[model samples]
Target chain A: PGLQMSQQQINPTRILVLLNMVTKDDLTDSDEYADILDDIREECRKYGNVESLQIPRPLPDLDVPGVGKVFVEFSSVDSAMTAAKAIGGRTFAGRVTISSYLDESKYFAGQFQ
Target chain B: EPQEGKRRKRSRFGEENIAERNLIGAQTVLPSNMTPLQQQCYILHLRIEDANMRLRTGRFGYSDDPSKRSPSPEPVYNGEGKRLNTREYRYRKKYEDDRHEAIQEMIKLNPNYHVPPDYRPPVQKLED
Candidate 1:
């Protein structure tokens, strides 16, 4: 708790949040979800090396807006930026998709909690 | 035989690579910075891209364009499973239409239409 503010602040280099796409039905079937992940990875891999892909699948009964969201972690910041620019506002699963960078701290915190 | 199959696959990918390159070459530079006019153009570009992708994939049969889905007067139903087409229905329809128009008018009157979210990137330690 010292007053020295010269600490090297870490920033997320390669994580994106995809919003307003993927419905409850999309994640129910293994084959369907695999196809979707393939489609997303194929589209995103055009930019750079995709390290990992995460899509939260909430229970079908749960009426949550954040359920069908996707998170893509690339190997580098440049690839993430390129993919975000290309994918943002484009139609995905018939919805106008939006994307932004995911906060590393919050993501890890939520995962642990 | 396996080598032949691999060569054929490579040739197919070569053709796809050429097409992808052409697409990249044809794409115009979209401004990264957001301005009012730029945002409008960006939306239009997204629409065009959506249409193009649909057309390319042969999945362009049905579309839900916003212009076709404008809010209209809601139809009221009678108890006997019939459409109420009386003078009162006409009046109510007009009133409902006027109310919808007022809502739309009020919505458009807002000058600050677009509000970009405050961006805060998640910080984490760099893994060695």
Candidate 2:
């Protein structure tokens, strides 16, 4: 699939992660949010070579925008799993409601195959 | 009388029943005489299938076809800057105001101005 491969080319293989979208009390710029993604990318790089990382930002219109959510992406299945296992539900910005994600369908579907 | 091309049948059992038995499995039709393991497996499969069909459609949304993962972040009054540091509010406010006005201009020129909600700018809702 072009979508999957392009993301992979940017950074091959991907596991999706959902994280706390709590705004930092310190960052202040369009680029500042970009920095959060960069931090996530750096964290991902710890487990293995990271090709790319994405964090989904919610719209400002949604009254609940500040803590809406963010998505973290990883390059390897194993790395993503490790990241999810090691850090899911860990505190972020003094909040502990964050979540780790995975490509669940791919893993679950494989069970039947 | 046997129909043409029909196999001779000395027993009560026949081919059509065999086909149905193959399709639905023999124990379904012959439940009265099922082995315990066969009955248990059949029951379990039925229960599992019932559970599976109810899986929310959104869960299977990501197809191998690709071209997905697009989330439109609405232009906000310093929303991103608000994330970085709440102080960049004024600059973000000006920028977002400009972005919305630009979108309004496009709406004026293009009859197809009805953008998908996700693609639209964040507008303040007035109280009644």
Candidate 3:
């Protein structure tokens, strides 16, 4: 599993997963959530065409998988690769964001956790 | 039995420590064939890394003791005078605002480019 993670870090995919970029409270407020979504989209568009973006929201009284993580699917692997390089380790919302390429099959299956 | 226990402890901590060290050292090397725009983006990424490290190392007025420094912009207090947020939260918010300013600078660099209609600029300031 560790080997696979390192391998994925070196490779590029169409889906990029960013961590530690947001907090649960930020998502709970509708206005704040909208602002965050807009900020992310605008920043990401600079790299390439974003096919879709997802940020799993926290559910009250329940632990949700992939909550607080931002997932971006680019239209091409090259775009995703560029975004991963540009965004990984960048500070967002005062947190050091960690970006990595996720397997397309796993992303499609919605296994964000 | 003592030796067995020692072996178990060593195996448990040793593997995890090595894995973590590798993960931290696993930054991808920049490819040589990148375009000028890509190079600029990479430089920004490196700058971000540098800033994060500086923060972690307590370079930007971060202290081990919470009371040593006054919270920037002042934190919100409830009616009873209890602070609504932690000191860490206040620092994080300030750091976030600083990063947004950096992004705004990056946007200004591309004067001819048109932002999307729905594009929202980063917040000028955040009030807790």
Candidate 4:
């Protein structure tokens, strides 16, 4: 079972999904949110060109999907994969970040909530 | 009486299963393309993550005592070079000192583990 789980690694894609990097409170504050986005972009751009970046913010009285998660779309799969390896397990906002590649189609369909 | 025994056995098995999962989760296989140095760094990264998990879940010593944990390090400015207020600084500082300590321990474990270069150095610090 452990072997199977290890083998189930997701394929590399142009979009990288980062988890555990932010909290709900961080996203709610407008200034903090912008700061986080800039911080992530500056860090990610070191690996390659970042085409688009998104950090889903929480909504009032609504359960927003993907809140506190960061999505970064790079110009190429290689860049995305590189960024994933570099950023994974790295600390952001004092939290260990877990990163994975996301499918381009799903990213485009706005399903990344 | 037999049913009670079976229920207790199942619960024990469940606990063991969870422990096994955690073991596997902590030492995931390193990527094949990495060099020996990169692999060592990756393992250190895993150690850092494990330490963070322990601190977060309060599984170990210092984690159990909130007052014993190290105070927050000085706040670094944001990407745009703006300083963060005290409240914001403390809020972001949580777990940072712990993470830094873990990284230091990891470096001690493997002297070959090269620390990644800091891409964003604090501009204010440099100016000072």
Candidate 5:
């Protein structure tokens, strides 16, 4: 009974991973990337206080996997959860956006810390 | 007396089955039975869970399947079909090299490096 109760009580996470938000070409120019980030951040801010935001810029050398994903950390888990639902299947940067909660440990990993 | 005992046994079994049914009904709702809007929300919940599972398991760099998008121009190569030794190439190479070193340094300051794993390398076709 206690174990079941604990499982049911799991809380939402405070980070969101926005996939395919921008492409490599979109990130090639620093100024353009910054502008894109600003646009994303502005849209994300509508859902909650964004604690941090990250978008990877893979160098031309390495075939860095998962390049166009965006991570947004919010002030509260509830807000992040709400934002993930609200953003699902919505169009962003001319592509359908697919977002999910970043696992707390993964959010703290070498990326998006 | 034997007949009475069998009836009592059947009644006890029936009560147990009803109790079990109630227990099941008391548990969380099932997604399959949800209304259309609720089902949609449930699916979104499952997708978020799936995404989180991939992230938490150190599967970031390897697992993402990106959607189709226009290919970006490839890095400029030389006329000899080799990566150019042009100033632009050197500059980009230097920047790329330093970027990782800077990331390491930043990690020392704030242990969580901001290298989110959502970058999908552009696919290249083999020329005939």
Candidate 6:
């Protein structure tokens, strides 16, 4: 019944999270702006130090108001991968649309699509 | 006699097709693997065309104001009572202007901008 349980077993590795979030409709106001950012940050922070973060502006022609579409960047690759793994196919603020990025050109090209 | 009438109808339809050739010249960007720059440029081009068409021919529109009837069959450029016409016109006008500027910017993006517009398919020569 004896098992070698050490600190690594207890401690958790931090993760980097990057996403291209597309909302169900356009963003009308700043209702979920801070909370949405914070949620993503908190989820990814568990993996490691959040070195950098970014959310790129929406496409010029698209008429997205509050949260139309965005590209979220994270510091650590592992953290980013972890958050991507966790949030794929999850609902954000009631809308069932959230996913992660693989950081590949073709994949991102698809996003341009 | 019936055949002659049918032939006349077909020729009239042909003329209609020729008239719509420019619109047929419009390029369709498949939602496939597109680079961001390419996508942006293509979208800009289409959006500009749409804006100009709305301004010139007055088709395909939106409304910023809620009071007046929007997207009506009768495009009323009326003012004094409703603000909807004014706001949408400005929005449409701004986009039209921006898109025009974008075309100039496009020339900078692609030094090959002087090339013929990608509108029609190349003609095929008949070999004897």
lDDT of each: 0.50, 0.37, 0.59, 0.59, 0.50, 0.39
Model 4, position B35: C-alpha lDDT score: 46
lDDT of 4 by residue, A9-81 (tens): 4567888887657778888889777778777888889999999998888889988766766889999988988
Residue-level lDDT tens digits of model 2 in B1-128 = 45797933221111122112222222211112334343333333322221122131212212243232222245454645545332234334433443455455545555554532333467679999
Deviation from native of the Cα of residue B72 in model 4, angstroms: 6.0
DockQ metric, candidate 5: 0.03
Would you estimate the TM-scores of all the predictions?
A: 0.42, 0.31, 0.50, 0.51, 0.42, 0.32
lDDT of 1 by residue, A1-113 (tens): 11111333323357776654576777888876777787788788898998988887666566543456778888888888787767755545444555556665645544411
Which portions of model 2 miss their true places by more than 4 Å?
A1-13, A21-29, A60-67, A102-113, B1-128
Writing each residue's lDDT as its tens digit, candidate 3 over A1-113 gives 11122222245688887765677898999977887888788778988999889899999899887787789999999888787767764546544455666678878888876
For candidate 3, give the DockQ.
0.03
- True interface contacts retained by model 5: 0.00
* Candidate 5 CAPRI grade: incorrect
Pairs in clash, predicted candidate 1: A103-B122, A104-B122
What DockQ results do all the predictions give, each relative to the true complex?
A: 0.05, 0.01, 0.03, 0.02, 0.03, 0.01
Q: Give the 10-residue window scoring lowest on summed lDDT in candidate 2 chain A.
A: A1-10
Error of 1 at A19 (Å): 0.8
Model 3 gets an lDDT of 0.59
* Cα lDDT tens digits for candidate 3, B12-78: 0011211133433324333334444543444444334434443455344344654433335657889
Top candidate (DockQ): 1
- Measured over all alpha carbons after superposition, the RMSD of each candidate to the real structure, in angstroms, is 17.7, 28.1, 20.8, 21.6, 23.9, 21.7
Clashing pairs in 4: none
Q: How do the residues B20-121 of candidate 1 rate in per-residue lDDT, one tens digit apiece?
A: 333212222222333434333333333333334333444432225533222335666689877776434553443334334333333355454332132122
Worst 10 residues of 6 chain B by lDDT: B10-19
Indicate the DockQ of the complex predicted as candidate 1: 0.05
Give every candidate's TM-score on chain A: 0.75, 0.54, 0.87, 0.91, 0.80, 0.48
Chain B TM per candidate, please?
Answer: 0.23, 0.26, 0.36, 0.31, 0.27, 0.41
